[model samples]
Target: MGYFKDILKYEKKYRRFTVLNIVFNILYAFFNVLSVLAFIPVLNILFGAEKRVIDKPEYNNISDLGNYLEGSFNYFISQKIISEGEIKALSLICIISLSLFFFKNFFRYLASYVITFLRTGIVKDLRDNLYHKIVELPISYFSEKRKGDIIARMTSDVQEVEVSILTSIETLVREPLTVIISIGIMLFMSVKLTLFVFILLPVSGFIISSISKKLKAKSIKAQKETGTFLSFIEETLTGLRIIKGFNAENVIEKKFNNSTLSFKQLMTSVFHRQTLASPMSEFLGSATIITILWFGGTEVLNNTSTLEAGKFMGYIVLFYTVLNPIKLITTTFYNIQKGEASAERIMSVLNTKNEIKDLPNANAKEGFNDKIEFKNISFKYKKEYVLKDFSLTINKGETVALVGQSGSGKSTLANLITRFYDVNKGEVLIDGQNIKSITKKSLRGLMGIVSQDSILFNDTVENNIKLGSQNASHDAIKEASEIANAAEFIEDLPEKYLTNIGDSGNTLSGGQKQRLSIARAVLKNPPIMILDEATSALDTESEQLVQVALEKMMQNRTSLVIAHRLSTIQKANLIVVMKKGEIVEQGKHEELLAKKGEYFKLVTMQSLS
Candidate 1:
């Protein structure tokens, strides 16, 4: 129920629709009771036990109002039969019953119709908020989370919340109202029989509650298994080449089968308990009906109760009507219990506080001016520091290349400069101001990054090049592509700039993808460029071409080049060689070679290998 309260926050946006549903459900419940009660007159006409009265009854108190109305209705029907005969009386009862039935279904349909807005609206808002959070959270947040689990939370888990929670909105409101109205009428018909029903209902409710007590826990387990298999599928698809090369299909299939087996077992328990709700409730309701018939019939025979035979029969029919609502309410309760697990999973993500957020008064840095400085910054992704007491300075419009073995803190500097992750100690400053004080959007806006992977979506060549500068003109995209040496091949494509690259630009070669990524950065035309191993994954011919494009893009731009290949950084203004998260040597390529230090060893090693 607490989770239900949290979910209602999304409902505030669609309050008008919610109110309409409530109003219609109320009408439906009211008419549901009236339709059953309307059958009493027809029962009397058929039984041939109609009572006639010459005078109209007087209303004295509210307590006897039920009996007074019952007698008055019987008297009017008796006179109708005496004056106009059974034909007119029968037609009149038929008309009243038909009207009640029509409105009962009409209001029921209206309730369902109004609830559609809430059901779909809440799911949409939930998905929107989840996606916003996924994008806004820092990259470190995803380092420990499985991508498939997040996808499951966003897709199937949300759908479960809809099926098990939001879809039951009508039953949650209407069924209880139906039960209350039916109970009230039962009490009016015979207090003793109604009292007997009250005695048995709590016991029945306790049994249903007990069965569903473990449903939420089981449901959570099933959903987690769903995520596990989905993650396996995502991983398998992404690495299909590796899997097939290794001949690991059977291993992967067996692991997936185990996960599905666990999910199937858990869901079996959850659904079995859920399925028991209806039959158990119906059985209890039938038992209550049989008891009421025996007691009410005994009272009528011994003359201890004032209920007429026709009214008692109608009372029994009305009580039977109450059973379906009770069963539906019980079923809805079980569904909510299961849905609470999904709601908790969703709210966990929504309620998480992002550790990285812009300050209320943070300054927006539109452009770089002076030097970019790392002032004794110590940082770590975990327990051990990746960069400890590291300090460097690069002036405006300078190219500084960082060369190191993997895990030597070269890439960490690029991340720090871009504010992807903040320093645990000291500061990363742009133009003598701490980068933390700058709004992240504005800070990253001044720089263009080309990573090793050359990530590209499935879109046109023009659209991929103009990703950052979406409003750039056709001539600008063409110029950027030419600058990256991609225009020659792109122009040879089927549609050139209008060509649709397949998934992740798989239709293009590695060199083409990397060039497209470079073209994107060139189109943005930012002052600062961070090329993190931009050409480390290419062949000799592709590397040479990409190197030419990289040099052209780096003209007069403040660039931080992280590279493994020593040939690429030979002409950099300053080359820093790093070992074990600390700088080992810093000088020109010729100067470092003359010293025969760490940079010299790297060059010699690459030359040997």
Candidate 2:
């Protein structure tokens, strides 16, 4: 009814394993009863009380039942003592009994072994789907969610699903089965005594259910707090340098203290509810057994019941055997309730609709032909539309530079071109086809993107640069590196192409990383490229080096360049000056400067004395 089924939807892939596990578990339960019955025979012989038969046992009704047993015992001992083999027959029965006991355990182990595959397979698929969903979601999703919370769902929350739910599946199937089988055996022995057991079950079930109700609430809070603290931890790692730089260690520490305190409160509640399961079940079980002995003993001692002394003790032991499974089942219910929270969290990610999925019947965008058009396109992150009635066009193989101050929709234009957030109104088209109508992979395949952040994985220099084109040969990678002017410094490194860049390529300088980004774009050799303030964060020399490399990559491709530095794009084919999401000026650098308009003012403001 909830995320349990949603999370277990992954288990459908292991249907064969599930069927086999159920079969083995059924066999295990059957033998669990037989193993207990094996003791009945041993006790029968020891107490000189094995059921016997008198005369020829008839094939009739309950009136003939005593005669059947009386006849059975007479024939057995008469043949045994005559041949002096009664003890040998007894030993043979014991051996068979032991074998049944061993087979039961063997099948039980098989059930556990088969279910291992299903549990681990579900976990692996859940994690894989979570990661896939994370990437496909709009960037705005990450903007609102904490990084630590996402990481917690992937790690700790998933582990909870494994430990609390996946691990309990066997108990879900096996424990109830053991309870049912034990109750059946107890009934066959004496239904009056068995019905007494039935009355106790509903009471035990009620108390366990009550404890489990509180578990889900506390477990949900615990998981939420785990996410909150994990977010704080992730933030601290990324901003450690900033925290120290500003001497704000105490402020950050206080924030962390608050998160952990909240987490501790929630977990305390969860564990408290979990602790109730064992003792409550144990008490109920003891009470049920004591009641059985008091009532059953009266009938046995008064000769009102046929149950013998050893047989009566064995039935009590058999009922006791169910006590542990019943207690375990109680604990399992609490665990499932706790794990239900994690399954909901995991399913939330898995169920999240990707905002950037491909259009139905979408096809790969071939190489660019006609000019790219941004025709009356409008968009926003949320609420207010930032780009209203916006339109522009970039010719083939021309660099169109977008320039403006912050919050003026300069970067929005860059993002829209990459389809990071699809336009809320109108359309962006390549050639004549709407960008939305083409698969994102195919559409993006034609363009090389270099963002202001220079996103790079923690990997080798060669791998980072080759990310845009993984099939590029080493010589081609070197050629691309040389073109971006990154080859000289790369050669000086200890491992050259094989050096690890650490997280986000932090081992490389801003300029060096930017050059590497350009090198990556160069290797891709796309028909169009988007460069968002590529050299804006660099010092003078670093800016010049990165700029020259970027210019080299831009030589033959259609480019959309967003620049804060006016000097870098003075030679751009056309400069589009924007203000508050509207184009105020669009023409060559000289023409916009000659007009003494918005573009001219921006340049005048940034000019050297």
Report the number of the highest-lDDT candidate: 1
User: Could you tell me every candidate's TM-score relative to the true structure?
Assistant: 0.97, 0.93
Off by over 4 Å in 1: 59-68
Task: Tell how far residue 81 is off in model 2, in angstroms.
Answer: 7.4
Looking at model 2, the pairs that clash are 52-69, 52-70, 52-73, 53-69, 53-70, 53-71, 53-72, 53-73, 54-70, 54-71
Model 2: ten consecutive residues of lowest lDDT: 50-59
The clash numbers for all candidates, in the given order, read: 0, 10
- Write candidate 1's Cα lDDT for 1-609 as tens digits: 788778878899999988998899889999888888867765665566654655778888998897788778877777787898878888988898899889999999998998999999999999999999999988888988889889999998899999999987789889888989899988877888788889988988997788888999999998888889999999999899999999999999999999999999999999999999889889988988898899888988888887877778888899889989989988999988888888888898888888778888899988888899999999999999999899998899989999989999999998888877888998988999988888999999999999999999999999999988989999999999999999999999999999999899999999999999999999999999999999999999999999999999999899999988989999888999887789989988999999998888999999999
Q: Return the TM-score for candidate 2, rounded to 2 decimals.
A: 0.93
Give the distance in Å from residue 507's predicted Cα in candidate 1 to where it truly belongs. 0.8
**lDDT values for all models:** 0.89, 0.85
